[model samples]
Target: MSKPVIDIAIGLLLHHGKVLVGWREAKQHQGNKYEFPGGKVESGESPEDACRREIYEEVGIGIKQWYAFDRIQHEYEDIIVYLHLFYAYVPDDLLTLIQQPWTWYHRDQLMQLNFPKANDTILQRLFWSHFIKIGDKLSEFQPHADSLFYWRVDAEQFQRDVLHTYSADDLTKLILNDEHYQQLSDDLKPLIKTLHLKQHQLMQFKKGDLELGKRYIAACHDLVALQHAEQIGCEAVFVSPIQPTQTHPHTKALGWTQLEEWSKQSQVLVFALGGLHPNDLAQAQLHGAYGIAGIRNF
Candidate 1:
């Protein structure tokens, strides 16, 4: 005999920059864990319908807009769970009507909470999505303070000079090239925030090989590459040559207008690359970029 498989639907309610989550009662399964508010799907209930019903029961609010986000299957000691996750948006007025004790958590703050093991995949997705939204707020982003520094230096330089420049807190996320990543010691690997992969490298990489806390960003020149990056589970995409640069002065640039158009169609967060400067942050946001990425100017 096989253990019963329970189908569950959950809602990730977003408002402003925070997400609403509720604490499970100590008596319930996965007790005391912080989770997106939801419940089991009744027989014949559609996942979307179940999500809406559960959200209303748990939070006392009806979701106005929602779409499927991700799905997960996990087997515990006694039961199997098929979790359906959805991203939802609710009106501000409904927030106060929630019956359960709930809290709004910022993306960074969520890292501290202890959620059920099965929720790890969704948690990572949420964190990346939140960070991408934050990247869009260019006026509030401080490169030295908030932005991850992309280090493209040689391994020898990294160990000698670059490593000593800042503490772990000052540079939490460091992006490294594939060669540099391979050269890193096991101890240094954990310190990296993301892996910067070229188009070919990204195509060759496997999603399962990705580390839990680290993110992957790939350089994409066109829509096909962007779609490929998203399919490969890349956290972000860099749409490059937005402006002609000294490195490739002859290459055509995708001006702000086209950049905006492309970004609107992109599935993943799009970063404007090529000939970008620190001052271009605002302009990048206007053109629908998550942020600006550059080799020399940044």
Candidate 2:
């Protein structure tokens, strides 16, 4: 006989640099562990609806907006669980209502606490919140420590040169834009583990069509593109033109309000791109970006 599969909706509430977490009951299946607020998904209820209901029931607060983050499945001795994770911000006025067993902890403190084994992947993704550098020349840009690179040069000769210039560990950080990525030689392809998809390429993408074990990131402009990215299993999406750019000054920027709206609307991790610098990190986070992607100021 097989164990029943159960669905769970989990919510991670962020407010003033802290995330809400609760302790599981001692007698429960995964007891005595600290967990992001959530509960089982009931029959006939959607995961998003279940998440909202669970958070309200457990924390005494209502969440009107949330962005989907990631999902995972794990099997314990008794049952299999499919976990859907979402991220939302809690208002300052409601902070006082979050009480005992449900406490707010700084992001850094999350890893130190005990959580269910299935949470390992989500925890790691949160820990490595990113910054991405997008451009041609490596020497021309100085990115933050441990930042990822979106190498956009398309010349086949230049692409190979760049790939061979960095060590394997360093190459792993590179997400080659589609043109350069497609031009790689068979041997050189394994050096880079991520692929950056242009809007058109993303439209044609399907699971199993690309090499396995690599991460795919899509360039998304709006909700429709974002939904497509999510459906195709992109690990992240670059939503661009957050500000008018030097490259295209006449192109109207999305501005902060629209950026925040896109972040709320999409489940995939959102990277704010265009006319941004490292200094914009705090401002971008305030609007709910997973990271910032830029060319000159990376």
Candidate 3:
């Protein structure tokens, strides 16, 4: 039998002035060098647990707000290794007491450091810290023009036979957990076509439960919604009722005044998602959005 394979979990730690990296002294045929902080994952231990243990043992600090980021597999030489990379933001103060011989490179200081295959891309994305919800297959993170471009679709568009579906964060988790839709939300699936995303979503003015995040779409403010989108790493947020219509005609409309206001001071991308269409895009852009997004046009 091929020798029993070992799994590895890595923590990509970011602090005020440095990122957590570790040196590989373990004996393996593969070249040993500095790498992200991690150790071989025990069969029974969860990835998160492994990461925490490795960090605490190697550096003597705690990780907070840990979240699953990516799972990558690679063949360095003859052996196949699986890497589960987790993201945890660290406070700026922890950079002082680190024990290991770790290098503290400024964000783009990769030239002198050694990075594994998937580490570069992951690191770049994490640094930008902004991602747009494209259709189900992909989500654009980097900017297209003056603004970050994102393709968004509502829950109504998800079940349709369309090629791409955009979703919020929660809806994405649901799609991933589904046996059938597990691969449905694959971010790299649509590389050949375009960037897409599937977000479960939260709102204060869209048509869902107010307790969560959905609002009636009419009650939301343009600036507040834009900030929420940026905070969640979304490239753009949709603001509706620009023209006023039946779906939510009763809800107050922000009208041109709000649109003009958004154009002046908002930091995130805004899509006119209310009773609007392709022709109306010019109006939205004129007010200050990169472009207009709407279900009616599609």
RMSD (Cα, Å) for all candidates, in order, is 8.9, 7.0, 10.3
State the weakest 10-residue window (summed lDDT) of model 1. 129-138
Best by TM-score: 2
- Summed backbone clashes in each candidate are 0, 0, 25
Query: What is the C-alpha lDDT profile of model 3 across 184-268, one tens digit per residue?
Result: 4455232212222223333322321221111111113446655443444332345656777666768877786687786455434
Whose lDDT is greatest here?
Answer: 2
- RMSD in Å for candidate 3, one decimal? 10.3
> Please, what are the lDDT tens digits per residue for candidate 1 over residues 61-165?
887456566678999988999998776655567878877588888766777798998998777555642122122222332435545556555545545234445
Pairs with steric clashes in candidate 2: none
lDDT of 2: 0.78
State TM-scores per candidate: 0.57, 0.59, 0.47
Q: Write the per-residue lDDT of candidate 2 for residues 1-298, one digit (tens) a residue.
A: 9999999999988764467888888998799888888899999999999999998898888877766766788999999999988767677778787766788776668889899999986665555346888877766433345688777765643536555766765666677876677678887787777788888888888644654445678998777887787666566789889998999998888898998887776556678999999889899989978789998776
